[model samples]
Target chain A: MSTFIQTLHLAWQNTNSLLCVGLDPEPTKFPGALANRSDAIFDFCRKIVDATAPFACAFKPQIAYFAAHRAEDQLEQLIAHIHLKHPALPVILDAKRGDIGSTAEQYAREAFERYRADAVTVNPYMGFDSLEPYLEHKDKGVIVLCRTSNPGGSDLQFLDVGGRPLYQTVAQRAAEKWNTNGQLGLVVGATFPKEIELVRSLVGDMPLLIPGIGAQGGDVEATVRAGRTAAGTGMLINSSRAIIYAGNGDDYADAAALAAQKTRDGINAYR
Target chain B: MSTFIQTLHLAWQNTNSLLCVGLDPEPTKFPGALANRSDAIFDFCRKIVDATAPFACAFKPQIAYFAAHRAEDQLEQLIAHIHLKHPALPVILDAKRGDIGSTAEQYAREAFERYRADAVTVNPYMGFDSLEPYLEHKDKGVIVLCRTSNPGGSDLQFLDVGGRPLYQTVAQRAAEKWNTNGQLGLVVGATFPKEIELVRSLVGDMPLLIPGIGAQGGDVEATVRAGRTAAGTGMLINSSRAIIYAGNGDDYADAAALAAQKTRDGINAYR
Candidate 1:
């Protein structure tokens, strides 16, 4: 079995579900009870982790939200807390880092070594050289941007490179050429279910990180249908704001847990 | 005049030189005197800025080094100091940030609205939408990664796409299509002089941020030859480590000043 399949098996056993809770703690959107305090962000994340740890397979923290508030240290602390508290739960640093050569090496060191994330999201514009550094961490996964679940993602990703859209070519290249370490995955945004199907076909058995199911208007049923690999082996459905900030009061953690359970139920129902 | 031409004129008038000192203050490379302290990084950068201000048209700070040590706050303080001390010196934030749509807008806000940099480097992988936010700042320049200086850059950049290398196509697109706001420039690494010349031909008059000149073994004369536009515009030759860490003692500032002067002299002699 591929490393991705083994990760899925572990995720399934740990959470009894494939729900990936997104830890995108935007400061402005923080609950009134925790506003104006940086530590509140950590508090909020820790509580969510505690509440949903039993129901979620992995935790994906969007780096941009933390970076915007100069909360890198807070993020590091949160990741450490996740590892220490729930050692089996994988931490995917959603940094979307892509650069060339030595700079790429530095980023790999920053994300995997210093930050100690189990996986990282990378943009494939600079091509394979950028991905190589991340793949060197054989035990960790390198998720490449295939067909993103955003409004403007189609603008460039769907551009006709030859007879087909660029993203299709990217998916094929990633599956055939770039998976030397068998640690490759593609981020197929949940919003674009049709593109998800196309990417699924191209990438074959590679794991798919299907984001945008909650706040981004992606149909959960269609995403599950389109993103599933052979025999449904590789799909990580991610929901950030929908799960974390499901409610704004003292019941936030319960609300998050309920949201996560609902997403898992939705996926299972479709299956 | 294009923003590129205007910047060239500004450089010639203010510093009487085409040199840019890159403040890539890696914490690991710092002398034993000021090791592992955020304040020390700022102090070191301040000294370099003060000493090199007269000889350099601008200062470029690689955000990675600061971020590596979790010294972004220190970097912000140092940049604020540079603005106050040398108001005429343009500060370029070498951040190489790119994302899809709304996320890119947030990044633009962080780099331009918050950091207040005169210019910020960006990647073109996610296409025009990722860059749209940066272009909204009419006066600030956006340096797009065209053909990088690293040895592994050519792995994908030189791939044949419609009978031209991908980088050349990017240059053409930037010049003809993406420069709608006239705020676009290209980062052509000094190490790849021939490719730099090719990109120059395609870009016509777009300003180029030429990195990899000093410690990266790029020939100063050859870089200038390939980068300068027909009107003697474009080209900002950046030297980071050689200028910033010229000495390790209290007299490091003086050594940095001398180094800056020498680099400027080299460019002028070549011109």
Candidate 2:
């Protein structure tokens, strides 16, 4: 199998898309049959995946969203379906997991083995050892949270560390010291395109997972302009609620597909 | 219903035990019948909890250990068992989960509603919003990771932010601003007694969940002296593998109980 980043590059070329469809399934937000709690998270995500697969470069399913509803089994099925049908598209398990050494190993297994994700998002607060276990997975991608999309992200991330922001230090570390496997990426929020640009300067050509674009009101042009590499690639622009819940009706999948296309085109215009 | 801190205080008083028995089950490390795969995580942890209950002020089940083995159902069952048998002892689910606002809500549901954990450990990397959801749980404890037990914790926790270390800054925030609910606590690793002392001084009698003491080689006396409040309470000294896996034979539960009692008495001496 090609490496996770390689597979992502392949998807970018084949589909000509940088859109990473975030599958954050809220049971209450589902339309029609999927909402009644019978046909569940798996069904809704499967439908959205099938509808938007061609237009998306990656799929990031936030683990909390699955684990909250105890829909992990369904999440497993959803990833299995994605691998079977949309093999080229990488699935990033957005589980910002951080812990000590041995515990970190289990979290890595949960992401790579239990769920069989191509990539996983991790929190950098615990430092290198917390991330070392995840990086040991040869072909999988380990994306570190640098500048998060939330407004409260600044609460700690912007603390000055040696005249540079903490997020910049994280980006520098992830780019320089932590990318031992060469299968690493950094999460720079779409809302903070300037920080994204700063991270881009720090980590040359490393993949950036950009969240907070569509529903969170991040500027698409600024995100693309700030994060994209020389090849006009290297960014996964994520839109979750905006795309997946575009319509609260029976044609939700169709609406999701349209939204995914619009998002993909919007990023491409800036590229 | 008593608040999470009140319940923890009650447990400490009733048991006269500062020890928190951490049930981190690695199936491979199981002894005899439990190791054969016929008996599962719940069975292993249930036995350990039953044996160590008298000596432990609380029980902390690390989520990664269960989720790694596709044992979420067992985790749910185990927490239910803890509530059923040891109603007085609080169960702190050590998940170390962190995310943005909306997703954090789902995680809060998982910890408080699905698993019914009395308290949960959270990573503070994403800042206040990531924690707001967990804080919303009326009587459940929200324990933020300050200075972790792992050596790698120094990677970011010790970064200089305005002449003070990052972890002290975290402790200040958790105590001053984030404890909107009376149920807030901080995870100050037993390994860092100096930092723990600093944290205690910052957040006056707030409960500090102290991990890394037993298997990780943290000094019990130092941990107890540094973390305890004026009333000789306000700490949950967690020992996971050191207590739970004290034996490799069928009498593992008996050995775990022995270890738990010894650990409890050791802390009581310091108090």
On lDDT, the leading prediction is 2
- Model 2: residue A213 alpha-carbon error in angstroms: 0.5
Positional deviation of residue A195's Cα in model 1 after best superposition, in angstroms: 3.3
Residue pairs in steric clash, candidate 2? none
In candidate 2, what are the lDDT values of residues A85-105, reduced to their tens digit? 999899999999999889999
| TM-score (C-alpha, index-matched) for candidate 2 | 0.98
Model 2 chain B scores worst on lDDT over the 10 consecutive residues at: B31-40
Can you tell me which runs of candidate 1 are displaced by over 4 Å?
A: A1-8, B1-9, B36-38, B245-252
lDDT score of model 1?
0.81
lDDT (10s digit) by residue, model 1, range A1-271:
3443466568766566768899977667767888866588788898999888888888898877777667778888999999999877788888787766556777787788778888888877777877888887778888888887766676556656667777887899899998897888889888888988898888777888888888888998888888776566478888888999898887899999998889888887775
Candidate 2 Cα misplacement greater than 4 A, ranges? B37-39
